[model samples]
Target: MKNQVSTIYKQAERFAEITKTAIITGNISRAKKCLALAEQLLITGSNETKIAISNVYLFSVSSFMELRHCSISNLFPKSLKAEYIKQINTSGV
Candidate 1:
Protein backbone atom coordinates (compact mmCIF):
# COMPACT_ATOMS: atom_id res chain seq x y z
CA MET A 1 0.00 0.00 0.00
CA LYS A 2 2.81 2.37 0.84
CA ASN A 3 4.49 1.69 -2.44
CA GLN A 4 1.27 2.24 -4.31
CA VAL A 5 0.68 5.52 -2.54
CA SER A 6 4.20 6.62 -3.30
CA THR A 7 3.77 5.78 -6.94
CA ILE A 8 0.55 7.75 -7.10
CA TYR A 9 2.19 10.79 -5.57
CA LYS A 10 5.07 10.48 -7.99
CA GLN A 11 2.66 10.40 -10.87
CA ALA A 12 0.82 13.38 -9.46
CA GLU A 13 4.04 15.36 -9.26
CA ARG A 14 4.86 14.52 -12.85
CA PHE A 15 1.41 15.52 -13.95
CA ALA A 16 1.70 18.73 -11.97
CA GLU A 17 4.88 19.62 -13.80
CA ILE A 18 3.23 18.95 -17.12
CA THR A 19 0.29 21.07 -16.07
CA LYS A 20 2.62 23.88 -15.13
CA THR A 21 4.25 23.71 -18.53
CA ALA A 22 0.87 23.81 -20.24
CA ILE A 23 -0.04 26.83 -18.17
CA ILE A 24 3.18 28.56 -19.16
CA THR A 25 2.46 27.84 -22.81
CA GLY A 26 -1.09 29.23 -22.41
CA ASN A 27 -2.77 25.84 -22.88
CA ILE A 28 -5.46 26.38 -20.29
CA SER A 29 -7.63 23.41 -21.21
CA ARG A 30 -4.79 20.95 -21.18
CA ALA A 31 -3.45 22.32 -17.96
CA LYS A 32 -6.87 22.13 -16.32
CA LYS A 33 -7.37 18.55 -17.44
CA CYS A 34 -3.93 17.50 -16.28
CA LEU A 35 -4.45 19.22 -12.98
CA ALA A 36 -7.74 17.39 -12.56
CA LEU A 37 -5.93 14.09 -13.03
CA ALA A 38 -3.29 15.06 -10.53
CA GLU A 39 -5.93 16.01 -8.02
CA GLN A 40 -7.64 12.68 -8.49
CA LEU A 41 -4.47 10.84 -7.67
CA LEU A 42 -3.80 13.00 -4.69
CA ILE A 43 -7.33 12.49 -3.45
CA THR A 44 -6.79 8.76 -3.32
CA GLY A 45 -3.60 9.07 -1.33
CA SER A 46 -2.98 9.86 2.36
CA ASN A 47 -3.07 13.10 4.29
CA GLU A 48 0.41 14.04 3.11
CA THR A 49 -0.81 13.76 -0.42
CA LYS A 50 -3.55 16.27 0.39
CA ILE A 51 -0.96 18.72 1.64
CA ALA A 52 1.09 18.25 -1.48
CA ILE A 53 -2.00 18.87 -3.52
CA SER A 54 -2.56 22.15 -1.73
CA ASN A 55 0.93 23.26 -2.67
CA VAL A 56 0.28 22.34 -6.26
CA TYR A 57 -2.90 24.43 -6.32
CA LEU A 58 -1.08 27.36 -4.72
CA PHE A 59 1.59 27.17 -7.39
CA SER A 60 -1.04 27.08 -10.11
CA VAL A 61 -2.97 30.00 -8.65
CA SER A 62 0.18 32.09 -8.39
CA SER A 63 1.15 31.24 -11.93
CA PHE A 64 -2.27 32.17 -13.20
CA MET A 65 -2.20 35.47 -11.38
CA GLU A 66 1.20 36.29 -12.84
CA LEU A 67 0.17 35.39 -16.37
CA ARG A 68 -3.12 37.21 -16.13
CA HIS A 69 -1.41 40.43 -15.07
CA CYS A 70 1.54 40.19 -17.41
CA SER A 71 2.22 43.53 -19.07
CA ILE A 72 2.61 42.02 -22.52
CA SER A 73 -0.58 41.28 -24.44
CA ASN A 74 0.41 37.90 -25.82
CA LEU A 75 1.53 36.41 -22.55
CA PHE A 76 -2.09 35.88 -21.57
CA PRO A 77 -5.19 35.73 -23.73
CA LYS A 78 -8.38 37.54 -22.80
CA SER A 79 -10.45 34.55 -23.92
CA LEU A 80 -8.69 32.36 -21.37
CA LYS A 81 -9.91 34.45 -18.46
CA ALA A 82 -13.25 32.67 -18.28
CA GLU A 83 -11.66 29.28 -18.66
CA TYR A 84 -9.17 30.06 -15.94
CA ILE A 85 -11.92 30.98 -13.55
CA LYS A 86 -13.81 27.83 -14.38
CA GLN A 87 -10.73 25.71 -13.84
CA ILE A 88 -9.99 27.29 -10.48
CA ASN A 89 -13.55 27.02 -9.34
CA THR A 90 -13.67 23.34 -10.13
CA SER A 91 -10.15 22.53 -8.93
CA GLY A 92 -10.32 21.04 -5.44
CA VAL A 93 -6.59 20.65 -5.37
Candidate 2:
Protein backbone atom coordinates (compact mmCIF):
# COMPACT_ATOMS: atom_id res chain seq x y z
CA MET A 1 0.00 0.00 0.00
CA LYS A 2 2.80 2.38 0.77
CA ASN A 3 4.44 1.52 -2.51
CA GLN A 4 1.23 2.08 -4.39
CA VAL A 5 0.72 5.47 -2.79
CA SER A 6 4.27 6.45 -3.58
CA THR A 7 3.81 5.33 -7.17
CA ILE A 8 0.72 7.48 -7.47
CA TYR A 9 2.55 10.44 -6.02
CA LYS A 10 5.39 9.98 -8.46
CA GLN A 11 3.00 9.79 -11.37
CA ALA A 12 1.33 12.99 -10.20
CA GLU A 13 4.70 14.68 -10.00
CA ARG A 14 5.52 13.66 -13.55
CA PHE A 15 2.20 15.04 -14.70
CA ALA A 16 2.94 18.30 -12.97
CA GLU A 17 6.28 18.48 -14.73
CA ILE A 18 4.64 17.82 -18.07
CA THR A 19 2.04 20.46 -17.31
CA LYS A 20 4.76 22.93 -16.51
CA THR A 21 6.51 22.16 -19.75
CA ALA A 22 3.23 22.55 -21.61
CA ILE A 23 2.69 25.95 -20.08
CA ILE A 24 6.19 27.03 -20.95
CA THR A 25 6.02 25.65 -24.49
CA GLY A 26 2.33 26.24 -25.22
CA ASN A 27 1.74 22.59 -26.11
CA ILE A 28 -1.85 21.37 -25.73
CA SER A 29 -0.91 17.70 -25.43
CA ARG A 30 1.41 18.33 -22.53
CA ALA A 31 -1.12 20.61 -20.89
CA LYS A 32 -3.66 17.81 -20.89
CA LYS A 33 -1.41 15.57 -18.81
CA CYS A 34 -2.41 17.38 -15.66
CA LEU A 35 -6.11 16.80 -16.23
CA ALA A 36 -5.50 13.22 -17.22
CA LEU A 37 -3.49 12.61 -14.09
CA ALA A 38 -6.13 14.22 -11.92
CA GLU A 39 -8.87 12.01 -13.39
CA GLN A 40 -6.74 8.92 -12.97
CA LEU A 41 -6.04 9.69 -9.32
CA LEU A 42 -9.69 10.27 -8.50
CA ILE A 43 -10.77 7.16 -10.38
CA THR A 44 -8.42 4.92 -8.42
CA GLY A 45 -8.95 6.60 -5.07
CA SER A 46 -11.24 5.75 -2.17
CA ASN A 47 -14.76 7.13 -2.09
CA GLU A 48 -13.87 9.77 0.51
CA THR A 49 -10.74 10.80 -1.35
CA LYS A 50 -12.53 10.77 -4.66
CA ILE A 51 -15.15 13.09 -3.23
CA ALA A 52 -12.46 15.47 -1.99
CA ILE A 53 -10.49 15.27 -5.23
CA SER A 54 -13.52 15.75 -7.40
CA ASN A 55 -14.36 18.88 -5.45
CA VAL A 56 -10.97 20.37 -6.26
CA TYR A 57 -11.14 19.13 -9.83
CA LEU A 58 -14.56 20.63 -10.30
CA PHE A 59 -13.41 23.95 -8.98
CA SER A 60 -10.26 24.05 -11.09
CA VAL A 61 -12.05 22.99 -14.24
CA SER A 62 -14.76 25.56 -13.68
CA SER A 63 -12.25 28.30 -13.12
CA PHE A 64 -10.16 27.35 -16.12
CA MET A 65 -13.13 26.97 -18.44
CA GLU A 66 -14.49 30.31 -17.39
CA LEU A 67 -11.11 31.89 -18.06
CA ARG A 68 -11.06 30.32 -21.51
CA HIS A 69 -14.65 31.36 -22.25
CA CYS A 70 -15.80 27.78 -22.65
CA SER A 71 -18.99 26.32 -21.30
CA ILE A 72 -18.76 23.83 -18.45
CA SER A 73 -20.88 21.44 -20.49
CA ASN A 74 -18.04 21.19 -22.98
CA LEU A 75 -16.30 18.82 -20.60
CA PHE A 76 -18.50 18.03 -17.62
CA PRO A 77 -21.54 15.97 -18.54
CA LYS A 78 -24.77 15.32 -16.71
CA SER A 79 -23.45 12.18 -15.09
CA LEU A 80 -20.41 13.96 -13.66
CA LYS A 81 -22.66 16.72 -12.38
CA ALA A 82 -24.94 14.21 -10.70
CA GLU A 83 -22.03 12.35 -9.20
CA TYR A 84 -20.49 15.56 -7.92
CA ILE A 85 -23.73 16.60 -6.28
CA LYS A 86 -24.23 13.20 -4.71
CA GLN A 87 -20.67 13.14 -3.42
CA ILE A 88 -20.98 16.63 -2.04
CA ASN A 89 -24.20 15.73 -0.24
CA THR A 90 -22.79 12.56 1.21
CA SER A 91 -19.27 13.74 1.99
CA GLY A 92 -19.81 17.46 2.53
CA VAL A 93 -17.20 18.20 -0.10
Candidate 3:
Protein backbone atom coordinates (compact mmCIF):
# COMPACT_ATOMS: atom_id res chain seq x y z
CA MET A 1 0.00 0.00 0.00
CA LYS A 2 2.78 2.37 0.83
CA ASN A 3 4.58 1.68 -2.42
CA GLN A 4 1.39 2.08 -4.39
CA VAL A 5 0.65 5.39 -2.74
CA SER A 6 4.18 6.54 -3.45
CA THR A 7 3.77 5.72 -7.12
CA ILE A 8 0.48 7.58 -7.28
CA TYR A 9 2.04 10.59 -5.58
CA LYS A 10 4.89 10.67 -8.07
CA GLN A 11 2.50 10.35 -10.99
CA ALA A 12 0.44 13.20 -9.60
CA GLU A 13 3.55 15.35 -9.36
CA ARG A 14 4.45 14.67 -12.98
CA PHE A 15 0.95 15.50 -14.09
CA ALA A 16 1.07 18.69 -12.06
CA GLU A 17 4.27 19.71 -13.84
CA ILE A 18 2.70 18.91 -17.20
CA THR A 19 -0.31 20.97 -16.27
CA LYS A 20 1.90 23.90 -15.38
CA THR A 21 3.81 23.64 -18.61
CA ALA A 22 0.62 23.48 -20.61
CA ILE A 23 -0.64 26.58 -18.89
CA ILE A 24 2.61 28.43 -19.54
CA THR A 25 2.46 27.50 -23.22
CA GLY A 26 -1.16 28.72 -23.51
CA ASN A 27 -2.49 25.21 -23.86
CA ILE A 28 -5.66 25.39 -21.87
CA SER A 29 -7.07 22.15 -23.17
CA ARG A 30 -3.96 20.20 -22.29
CA ALA A 31 -3.74 21.79 -18.91
CA LYS A 32 -7.32 20.86 -18.17
CA LYS A 33 -6.70 17.30 -19.25
CA CYS A 34 -3.60 17.00 -17.06
CA LEU A 35 -5.44 18.52 -14.15
CA ALA A 36 -8.23 16.01 -14.59
CA LEU A 37 -5.73 13.15 -14.53
CA ALA A 38 -4.14 14.49 -11.38
CA GLU A 39 -7.53 14.72 -9.77
CA GLN A 40 -8.25 11.13 -10.66
CA LEU A 41 -4.98 10.05 -9.04
CA LEU A 42 -5.92 12.06 -6.00
CA ILE A 43 -8.94 9.82 -5.51
CA THR A 44 -6.68 6.87 -4.77
CA GLY A 45 -3.85 8.75 -3.11
CA SER A 46 -3.13 9.04 0.56
CA ASN A 47 -3.72 12.17 2.60
CA GLU A 48 -0.19 13.47 2.12
CA THR A 49 -0.31 12.91 -1.61
CA LYS A 50 -3.65 14.66 -1.85
CA ILE A 51 -2.35 17.67 0.03
CA ALA A 52 0.79 17.83 -2.08
CA ILE A 53 -1.12 17.66 -5.35
CA SER A 54 -3.57 20.28 -4.12
CA ASN A 55 -0.72 22.60 -3.27
CA VAL A 56 0.86 22.04 -6.66
CA TYR A 57 -2.44 22.77 -8.38
CA LEU A 58 -2.95 25.93 -6.36
CA PHE A 59 0.57 27.09 -7.03
CA SER A 60 0.33 26.37 -10.74
CA VAL A 61 -2.97 28.23 -11.11
CA SER A 62 -1.86 31.17 -9.03
CA SER A 63 1.41 31.49 -10.93
CA PHE A 64 -0.43 31.33 -14.22
CA MET A 65 -2.88 33.98 -13.10
CA GLU A 66 -0.07 36.25 -12.04
CA LEU A 67 1.86 35.74 -15.25
CA ARG A 68 -1.19 36.34 -17.44
CA HIS A 69 -2.68 39.05 -15.27
CA CYS A 70 -5.97 37.20 -15.43
CA SER A 71 -8.67 36.51 -12.92
CA ILE A 72 -8.82 33.15 -11.17
CA SER A 73 -12.45 32.82 -12.11
CA ASN A 74 -11.52 32.72 -15.79
CA LEU A 75 -8.61 30.32 -15.58
CA PHE A 76 -9.77 26.75 -15.13
CA PRO A 77 -12.62 24.73 -16.55
CA LYS A 78 -15.74 24.66 -14.38
CA SER A 79 -15.40 20.95 -13.73
CA LEU A 80 -11.74 21.28 -12.77
CA LYS A 81 -12.50 24.11 -10.41
CA ALA A 82 -15.36 22.18 -8.89
CA GLU A 83 -13.17 19.11 -8.41
CA TYR A 84 -10.42 21.20 -6.83
CA ILE A 85 -12.86 22.74 -4.41
CA LYS A 86 -14.23 19.34 -3.55
CA GLN A 87 -10.70 18.04 -2.96
CA ILE A 88 -9.89 20.88 -0.64
CA ASN A 89 -13.09 20.45 1.31
CA THR A 90 -12.69 16.70 1.64
CA SER A 91 -8.99 16.84 2.47
CA GLY A 92 -9.40 19.63 5.02
CA VAL A 93 -6.64 21.62 3.40
The candidate that achieves the highest TM-score relative to the unseen native structure: 3
Assess each prediction's global lDDT (C-alpha) against the native.
0.54, 0.53, 0.63
Look at candidate 1 and tell me the lDDT of residue 2: 53
In the range 1-93, model 2's lDDT, one tens digit per residue, is 654534433544444455545645766565555555556657777775465546545454544555667544534445445554565577664
lDDT of 3 at 64: 61
What overall lDDT, based on C-alpha atoms, would model 1 receive against the true structure? 0.54
Clashing pairs in 2: none
What candidate 2 gets wrong by more than 4 Å, as runs, is: 1-25, 71-93
- The candidate maximizing lDDT is 3
Better-scoring candidate (TM-score), 1 or 2: 2
- Itemize residue pairs with steric clashes in candidate 1: none
Local error of candidate 3 at residue 2 (angstroms) = 24
Runs with alpha carbons beyond 4 Å of true place in candidate 1? 1-14, 70-93
Query: For candidate 3, what is the TM-score?
Result: 0.53
